[model samples]
Structure formats: C-alpha cells, structure tokens
Target: MQTFTSYDGTTIAYRVWEAPADAPTVVLHHGFASSATGNWVVTGVVDALTAAGRRVVAIDARGHGDSQKHHDPAYYGEDAMARDLVGLFDLLGLDRVDLVGYSMGGVVALVTAAAGRRVRRLVVGGIGASAAEQGGVDRNSLVGAALIEALLTDDPSSISDERALGFRMFAEATGADRKSLAAQARASRHTPIGLARIKVPALVLAGVDDWLATRPHVLSSALPDGRCKVLAGDHLTVVRNPEFAAAIVAFLAD
Candidate 1:
C-alpha cells in the first residue's frame, strides 16, 4: 500500500503491482462503499490483469477503505477523485495508463478521460445511459438526500427505498464510515457529463441484469470511440465473474 496527498491535502491510498518492462500499466478505481481489495483485488481483477502481463494500480477512494475519511461533502466527488488520479500519474511520472473503474469509480474515470488526461484506454462498468442522461447517477437532489439519510440515520427501518436500504446494509457489513458516506451522497453531481469529449478507445461495459446499467448502447453511442459489452450477472456479481476480467483483459490487450 502507498499513499499520496491529493489536491485538498487529503491522503489517498493505493496499491501497485509491477509487470514486465514492455507491458502496459492499468489503474483500477473502485465503486462507492467498496475498497480496492473488495473491488479489484478480491474480485480477481488484479490477478487476471497481472497474469496477462500487465501492471496494476488500484486505489481506495477518499472517505472509503484505507484512505482519509473526510466528513465534509466538499472533500468528495468525481471531479476531486479525477484530479487525484491525474496527480498520481504526475507524481509517478507515468506517461499513460489503461484505466478501469466501476460504479462511482466509473464516473471518476469518465470525467478524467474526458478531460484528456494521461489515460490511454478506459473501461467503465456498472453504469449505462445514466452517464449520458444524468451524469452517471446524479443523486444530488431529493434522491441523493434520501440516500444520505439512509447512510446517516440511526434506524435502518426508516429507509424505505430498497436501493437505499441495500446501500446501508452494505456499508454496515463493510464497516465503512457512514458519516463520510453521507457526505459523499450530499456531494453527488447534478451536472451533465460530456461523453463525446473522450477521444481515446473506451469500453463501456455493463452487466446484462444490472438495473443501473440499462441500455448501455446509448452510452457507447455517445462516446467518440466507445463500444458496449454486456455480460451475465448484475452490478454486485459482475466483477466476480471470470468473464468480467476476461473482457477487460481482452479490451486492454487491443
């Protein structure tokens, strides 16, 4: 594990594995409430990529995992996380890297790649037209408030929304900081995402049964060089599937 100071002086945590001299490096950013271990390492993504002769870099986003926990909403968001990624590249003197992200991490990668940073390739999953329509799950409004309540409230039964309840249960099971998660919900973006700006080759992946990633073709059509691939499973189970890593290995090998 390694740590770097982000733009706001918040400490960001990451892990890296080296590959052969000629192989490409891949960066993995996890989803909300998931750490690097839970998202990529335990899911067999790191092993798959490393076995394919590719270097891997996985991060534990601020307010999650081993990273700094900031209770302020201002400290968390895709924009901030994107900047942290670009900064990581700069600090490491990396020219470019193949980036992969899931769920909330997907939004961060999209925003970073769209800005024309040092990203060579992109693969974002657990998202779909929501990326084009609502900037990839913009719960910044009432829906976001509900989610915040789900994260902060003392009583679990108070959360009426099934998805919100799921998030709460997942957070508790993971032993995550609920207050920080509430701040993250409070900071959800309300603006639209400019998908057309990303010029690099991109794979907009989604699980066939994922409700959050419906009609991924729309997301693919929106990007300059994007294609959609749907695999078996839903949002939670997709990353654990062997085909998921296989798809990413094949895409980055291109």
Candidate 2:
C-alpha cells in the first residue's frame, strides 16, 4: 500500500496495478464504509481492468480503509475527498486519467468533474442526481443514528432498518472504524450547481433494483456528455458483479 498526503496533510492509502505502456490508467474510488481492497480488489474489479489492458489506481478514502480516520466532521465534506483525489494526482504527477466512483465515491467523482479536473472519462456507479440535490440519504437521520448505535453496541436487536443493520454488520465484520464512519455521514454531501460545465464523457451507472439511488437518467441528461447504464443487481450487489467492471472497461475503452 502506497501513501499520499492530502491538502490537509491527512495520509491516504492507495495501490497501483500497472498495465502495459499503451494501456490507459483508471483511478477507482470505493463507496461509503468500503476500502479500496474491499471495493475494487476483492470484487475482481482491479483484475478485470488490468486484464482489460488498463492500469488501476485504487484509493482508500479517508476514514474508510487503511487511510487516516478522523472523528472530526470538519475534516470531511462533499468536496474534501474529491480534493484528496486531486492532491493524489498532483503528488503522483498524473495530469489525466479515467475515473470510476461507486456510491459515496461517485459523489466525490461527480464533484471532481464539476470542478473541471483533468479526468479523461468518468464512470459513476451506485449513485445518481439526488446526491447533487437535497433528497439523498441523510447521515444524521434516525436510521443513521440507529445504525451507529448498533455498531457501537453488542446488542444487534436495536437496529430495525435492514440496510442500516447490514452496514453495521459489514463495518463490524470488516473491523472498520465506526466513529470515523459516523463523521463521514455528516461530512459527505454534494450540491452540484453546474452540470453542463462537466464536458468530459461520463457514464452514469446504476443497478435496476437500486432504489436508494436517485434517477440515473436525470443525471445523465444533465451532463454535457453523460449517458446511463443499468446493471442487474441492487446497490450492494452491483459492485461485486463482473458486469459492473465490464461496463466500466467498455466505456473507458471507447
């Protein structure tokens, strides 16, 4: 695992799987409560991309994996993680590359694209337009609070929401930092104002059963060069599907 310092000097963990000289590089951002390895590596995404003749740069977002975990909500924001990505590129002297983001990572990538970063192509998976507006998931809500409580306690009966319970279980099973994830709930909220500003080719991907995500077509229609693709699974299952990586490889390959 390689490390890089972000704008705030927060240490971020990343790994690079190099492809052939002519192959393009693709940076990957995992979803909330997921690490780089858990998202891309274990899901067979890294191997798929690498086999497809593309270099893979997978980053563990702050508070998610081996990276620095800050309990302070001030350390996180809608664009803070995006800034980390930009800083990562700066540190590596990489001017441009293909980018793929899932769930929370998708939000960061969208914000990065809105910032006019040098992303060659973008594949946003497991997220949609609601992330840019107000109707998306709320971290401080009753359900979120319940999830945290479940994660902190041994008694699992208190978590009524199945999704929240699933998250708590995943976090515990993965030994993820619960407090840092709580802070992430407060920090990650995107409010994209100018969709037309992002002129790069983008694929807005979602699962057919992912009701958690907002309308993917809306997001695609808003962007200057955006299109929608739906996979066959829900939010949690979609990332693990080989089709997810296949869609990304196809889009970036073009």
**Which candidate comes out best when scored by TM-score?**
1
Candidate 1 deviant stretches above 4 angstroms? 138-142
Over 4 Å off, model 2: 135-154
Q: Per-model C-alpha lDDT, please?
A: 0.87, 0.81
lDDT of 1 by residue, 1-254 (tens): 99999888999999989888475579999998999999999899999999999989998989999999999999988888888888888877778889999988999999988886678899999888878888866342227767888999999988998888888999998899999988887776646778888999999888898877888888888999999999999888999989999999999998
lDDT of 2 by residue, 1-254 (tens): 99988889799999998878464579999988889998898889888888888878989999989999999989886578888999888877778879899888887887787786689898988876675454234333325556656656677777777777888888887889988888887665735546677799999889888866657888788789999998888878888888898998889988
Report per-prediction Cα RMSD to one decimal: 1.6, 2.2
lDDT score, residue 214, model 1? 84
lDDT of 2: 0.81
